[model samples]
Target: MKTRQKNSVQGRTPLVLFLALYQLAGGLVGLGLCLKMIPALQQPSTSTWVGIVLAAVLYTFSILCGFLLFQVTRQAFLFSLANQILQVFSFGVTGLAYNYVAGLKVGVGVDFLTSWVFKLKFSLSSFTFSVGTHTGASFVAVNLLALVLLYLLERAKEAANV
Candidate 1:
């Protein structure tokens, strides 16, 4: 008897595993955001609701990726692609959503697209730590880099196998 390989693509296992771990990490971050939102839920601000909804979506994608990427199966490739695309877009969309929410809170967005929206109207105090500050953008940038690295690693591994 011989050990059978599913999908006959063992070389692609690293891509699947890396995507799963990355998605799991992102999902954990979403969980953290959700935990933070618990106390704020009492007030139920627009931003808080946005955070909750985004976290839910993130968790769903994370679970899907983690489960599907565990084995080098036929559908693992599709799930890996799904995970990467979701993270990449989620990061960008989350930033925009946060900006929109921040602008609305500060009387700037949707109703009026003013320079104040571009400016950091989130927090004017000495503590430069605000929720809607460029955090979403930074998150998106980080995920994009992860996707690029994943691609490079996959290509290099495939070449090495060849």
Candidate 2:
């Protein structure tokens, strides 16, 4: 059960942990992917090196965000908000372009939803969002979802205390 503390941040422990873990996994996986690709991506040219560097930096940001989220820090929320704002454009352009943005392919397809469950057809490397493609995303949905959950939990906690 969640308690209504007098004047502390409203937090739902399980949801917070879930959101943290989600981001943490994202960071770790992204970092691991970048690290794994480095050897293959290595080249003697400056331009080639830039790609590797950018990959490292991107993963680093993810790791930092996960860390802040895990700690439930205000900075984490701010950073996440900023990231989302940027991603809005990123996802929109990529989604609309319907092309691979740096080896990522985005597509738009209608999802067929029936009953309460969303039927899924899963593959080893990826799974369909709902047996369709429309408004393809660069995994932005995960971050957005986590942010919403975090905000909702915080609001719930606030309401509990008041």
Candidate 3:
């Protein structure tokens, strides 16, 4: 019985690990882009400051979610699921449902098999991040994918009784 459980757990390891790595990379990429805006903060713009701070907070949560997923515990699954749900609401519903945010413009988007890449820009009127309001599709897809990842994590946890 123990061996069977071990095998079941091992079978899901690759998928969970991949998701963890993806989460970590996404967070890092997001934070790195946010860092680029730090110099712009020297200017006087409340929206810039607000946007940067909000993006940083969201990306930090992504990083934390990644770390929790690495633990592969039942609690981790639950926590990550919560985070994903939040992202879906924040990134998907607000981002796509309304179709736009004031003063925020979607830039050129480069899509990968599992990720999206876009240029980060700072200006007097607008600021953007690599993962910012570049593409509604990317945000929608990523948020949905995150939920799927959490589902898989839950399965892995159940398989291992963890």
Candidate 4:
């Protein structure tokens, strides 16, 4: 019984660790991207400020979600799930705001939702990777994955209870 308990605890360690790290990294990336737009805020309109605020809120949720997930508790899983759902909606709003500011005629239609690209380039001595816009189907997939992870964590907790 002691050995079984130990193994079960160990089994959960990696998943918890991965979730924590993923959240932290995601928060940092989001903050960085938001910072890039700070300069554009100069002489900005109300719409731009609104966009910035929306981005800030979304990224803050991501960071908090990451921290909560690190707790490795059932409560944390629930909170993370809620946060992920909010992030999904906010992501769309933020994208639309930024797109409008940038004068891109893109809309949240099927084409915008489904298009995604990731490219890698290598030279004799250097390697480079490039990705499409920050918001798209790929990001939606990421959010969906996070939601799935939270569900898995919830299941794991339920199993542990059993």
Candidate 5:
């Protein structure tokens, strides 16, 4: 019985270690992208580009964080909470930063897809008034759901262990 338990632990060790490494890599990549966009954010003409870059960075980071949380907690409920928090924070920061850098007097709220689709207007005023796409919202919802599922699975694993 002891040998059996030891073998099981050994078998799971690699997977757990891999998950930890993956989480670290994802975090580093996300941080790097965020840093890379900072300089672009300072330039007035490149503000739109900065927005794009920042969105990509935040999205990637959120996904990675979700993955890490899922691996660690194996509880979807907790993961969902973390993901939702990240989504809201990312959206708020990106929205504010874009407006400041682009010199939008009013404010901007363009979605991921629509921003590229509707390029007819280039004025700072026009861009500022743009609304974001549903895709961003959908991403947040999906992540939330995933976290919930993971939480349930984690609970099951605990029960099985007992």
Candidate 6:
């Protein structure tokens, strides 16, 4: 009996695997951040250092994730291109979602603290973070452009392979 080799060209297993791992890591980190933020928000006398540390951890994880994505995708031009494109979309959507969620969380936290911790009548007006609309749109555009470039690169690779 002879063993046959399977084709690796059609199905994007490597890409899928990389994406899954990235999402899993991101999800875990986000969950942890949410948990930390909620507790801090609930405590009226929470230390500013705690907030700073949490922000730093979130930033570090974000940077690490970007590096990991780049490392994983660099192995294949096609995958890299696709990822570069998808990253833009992902970032924009994630940013918007984060903004909305964070705002809600802050409001809830303030309310919880006022009612439970402080036992004072307090009304919080606004909570703001640095995410901007222009930034998200720019990221989306860049990703779309990268996808186009990746398509060209893949085509070139195919031609070369032939």
All candidates' lDDT scores?
A: 0.44, 0.42, 0.53, 0.47, 0.37, 0.35
Which regions of candidate 3 fall more than 4 Å away from where they truly are?
1-12, 41-44, 90-143
Q: Largest lDDT belongs to which candidate?
A: 3
lDDT winner between 2 and 4, please give it. Answer: 4
Model 4 spans > 4 angstroms off? 1-12, 87-109, 112-147, 159-162
RMSD of every candidate to native, in Å, equals 9.8, 9.6, 9.9, 10.2, 11.8, 15.5
TM-score to native of every candidate shown: 0.49, 0.50, 0.55, 0.54, 0.32, 0.27
lDDT of 3 by residue, 1-162 (tens): 787556545645876777666666666776777787587656646755776777777667767877877766566667666655554322232223211111112233233426665433222112233333435443332233444665876776676566
User: Could you give candidate 2's per-residue lDDT for residues 3-78 as a string of tens digits?
Assistant: 3232224542565555555555655665676577667754446644654565556556655765665545555655
Report the C-alpha lDDT of model 1 over 1-162, residue by residue, as the tens digit: 133343334544565566566566655665555566578556686865665666566566666665655654446555555544543321223224321110011111121222222222221100011364444433212233435744854563354242
- Which tens-of-lDDT digit does each residue in 49-160 have in candidate 6? 4444554454344434434433333334444344334333221332331211110111111112124332222121111233433333211112233344446545544543
Model 6 alpha-carbon miss at residue 46, Å:
19
Pairs of residues clashing in candidate 2: 108-133, 108-134, 108-135, 109-133, 109-134
Output the better candidate (1/3) by TM-score: 3
Task: Report model 3's TM-score to 2 decimal places.
Answer: 0.55
lDDT tens digits by residue: candidate 4, 32-146: 6677768866698665676567666656666776676655555666765665444322123222322111100111322234454432211111111122324433221123343
Candidate 5, superposed: residue stretches over 4 Å from native: 1-12, 43-140, 144-162
TM-score ranking from best candidate downward: 3, 4, 2, 1, 5, 6
Question: Model 4, residue 88: what's the lDDT?
Answer: 29
**Candidate 1 regions with alpha-carbon error over 4 angstroms:** 1-15, 45-51, 89-143, 149-162
Q: What shift in Å separates residue 33 of candidate 3 from its native position after superposition?
A: 1.0
Off by over 4 Å in 2: 1-12, 42-44, 89-162
